[model samples]
Target: MTSFEFPGQYYELMRRDFRNLAAETDFLASLLPDGGRALDLGCGTGTNLRELGARGYCGVGVDQSASFVEYARRMGGEGVEYVHERVEDFESEDRFDLVYCLFMTLNYLPRAELRRVLRKMRGLLLPGGHVVLEFGHLLNFVESYQPYTVAHHRGDGVLVTRLARQSLNPRAANWRNEETLLVREADGRVSMYDNFFDQAVLTGPEVRELLADAGLHVSAEYGGFRKEQVPPHGRGPVVIVATAEGAGAL
Candidate 1:
């Protein structure tokens, strides 16, 4: 499986179309304790950490893209740090009250490597700490498997268009995702970027089993960040919250 290296200049613009950073940060913050320490795995551009930092939460964000890390550092605020490193190689001596891997980041890791990463995340947690994971919903994949396009026009005279396609590879037991981005700058210059990767197809039960194997207990499963319960054929992402085994009182 390969990983995506997003274009740093256009990432924030692309993300604004799908994610509400402020609302997502608020939801994540609600899970943390007072002045808690948090770690973000695959934290692209460090937007969430920047938001969390303003709430007095000390945050560390790790991503593989140097451009993203550099951009994040440039937009730095108090209590947040950005590291340029792959999730597999990132290590910290200090423990955190919350460790989160969002946007289906774990799906890119090989199964065995993913298990190891989960174990590592478990080790990095303080007692009573929580680990939040987000994965694309299996039902959505199987039910609505089709190519899609996203287009954004900014007031700054930049137009962005993304063509995305994903298909199941039955033999590989995974899905191959391909995306092409076309960006037109205000100066009439156009650039194209392409990204392709294979991701594991994960369901709630599989996520539960995996977390249990890593010594984490599932405490809640939501269809979205708003704590919505998942229906049999819901179209939202699968968000799971798990706590470390034998956790102390928070």
Candidate 2:
């Protein structure tokens, strides 16, 4: 599996990262005690970690993109530190009260790599700590396939275009896809890039089994950031709430 994790591209992403930073922080805070320590895996630009710092939570974030790490470091407040490294290779004796990997980040990894990343997360988790992962919504599997494409012309006269196709790879039991993006500047400079990758798919009971194999157990599962219970008939991403397999307490 491959990803467009190039740090330079993060600048374009930062301008439009629409995640509700406040609500995400509040949800995380609700899961832990006061002054808790947290770790964010695949943490992009460390914006989330910065928010945790504001809430009196000390946070450690790791991402493979140096641009993201630097961006986070520059924008950070007290009690937030970032490391630029692959999530699976991150070695820290320090454990966290809350450890989370969200935003379909794991979807970028193949199955073997996903297991390694999960094991690393398990090891970094403090006893009784919880882990959150964004499993692509059940709707992804249920909904009919459709071509995905988007174009945004920023006020700054920068046009960003994205086009993509997705399909299942039955032999690998994963999603095989390709995407192309173009950046056009008003100054007449244009850059184009394309990417092909495969992402592991976790569906239904099979997902629970994968987590169990990683020494984690599902504590709860939601439809999205709203914490809505996942219904069988629903069509949305699966945000799973998990904890160390054999540990007790929150």
Candidate 3:
């Protein structure tokens, strides 16, 4: 296996292959206030922040990965900033109109940590500000399970291929994912990187309860990127849109 000091350096390369950032941002934009501050918890590579900035929103992206933060900073943009810090320890005097944690970032945290992070997010937001969370549902894992899958992308004379695998541990109530990346550079050099992640398996009701405990009231829920409501045990992404208690509809 080829080694990389910071595998996250190539994160952007494979991100688009798996997600439609443009569409995702479009949906998020609709939920955001007009031209106010925003915070991206667990922002990976700052792609979403850059998109938000383009839409005239000043934003801050916080992540624990130094490599990802460095990459995001180098791809700088007006009204966008990147911070290197874990979500649990991140602090800011600025109150945001929108605070979002996307792509199942919170799922990686244990229940206790996730609760703390949710509370922290709530505290960082202005009254009536929104908090959007994307979670990986247990049904999604079960329905989408496969031995392995491959994704390939080429851009700017660089090519990347990723192999992904997932498994569910019912007893542990956690889902595990493994990914391997094969990269080919313009210089004809080849390298490989591997990564693994474990996410807690949570149902919609459980997520709602957690949000309630954190003083956030759920206003909307979706199974995926679409705005439509999903079944309680939906077999796809579990997206929760909420605002602090007593903060009425937007």
Candidate 4:
């Protein structure tokens, strides 16, 4: 089994995948409300920040990956700023109109750690500011057994990999999943990495309860930006839109 670590070196590669999967322009347009300031947790290579900037929002991206942070700085535009730091230890006196965690990054944290991170995000948002979380629908695992391969070419080099052996433990409530990544280079060099993730797979009702426990209100829960209800069989990812209670409401 391959050991997974925070801020992996392949983050930029993963970012490219996300940019393709997520309709960044539309997603940012839908989430940015009046657009004062925004914080992107687990910002990866800052692709989302760039998308938000294009939509006229000032964006700051935070990620644990130093390589990703540096790459983002070099690609900077539209008032985008990148910070290299872990979400748990990141400190800021400034608050944001919107705080977002996307791409199932929150699932990497343990339950206690996930709660701590949520509370930290809560503290960073202005009263009534929105927090949007996007994660894979856990129920999809029931049918997700097929292996898939993805490849990309950079200059003269090619990166090819196969992902296979998907498994999940739903009873744990943390949505633990396992898979393997096999990497091959044009130079004939090969490497393999095994990835294990513990995701908090809250059903719609469970998510509502968790948000309430965190002192936030569930403004919306969508299977996708398409705004469909979560299908019983989990056809798509889940997007959660929540708002911190205004000071008066608190």
What does the lDDT come to for candidate 1?
0.82
Candidates 3 and 4 compared by TM-score, better number: 3
Candidate 3, 193-225: lDDT as tens digits = 777777787777788888999999998877766
Q: Please provide, for model 2 over 171-230, each residue's C-alpha lDDT reduced to its tens digit, 9 standing for 90 to 100.
A: 776776687767777797888777666667667576677788789988888877778777
| Residue 1 miss distance in model 3 (angstroms) | 21
Worst 10 residues of 3 by lDDT: 1-10
Deviation in angstroms for 76 in model 3? 0.6
In model 1, the Cα lDDT at residue 202 comes to 73
lDDT of 4 by residue, 37-72 (tens): 899998877877887787788978988767668877
RMSD of each: 2.2, 3.1, 2.9, 4.4
Tell me how far the alpha carbon of residue 127 in candidate 1 is from the true structure, in angstroms, after superposition: 1.6
TM-score of each: 0.91, 0.82, 0.89, 0.76
Task: Return the clash pairs for model 1, or none.
Answer: none
RMSD of 2: 3.1
Lowest lDDT 10-mer window, candidate 1?
147-156
Compared with the true structure, all predictions reach lDDT values of 0.82, 0.74, 0.81, 0.68
Question: What root-mean-square deviation over C-alphas does model 1 reach?
Answer: 2.2
| Candidate 4 TM-score, true structure as reference | 0.76
Task: Please write out the lDDT profile of model 1 over residues 42-75, one tens digit for every residue.
Answer: 8988888988998999999998877788889999
Q: List the residue pairs that clash in candidate 4.
A: none
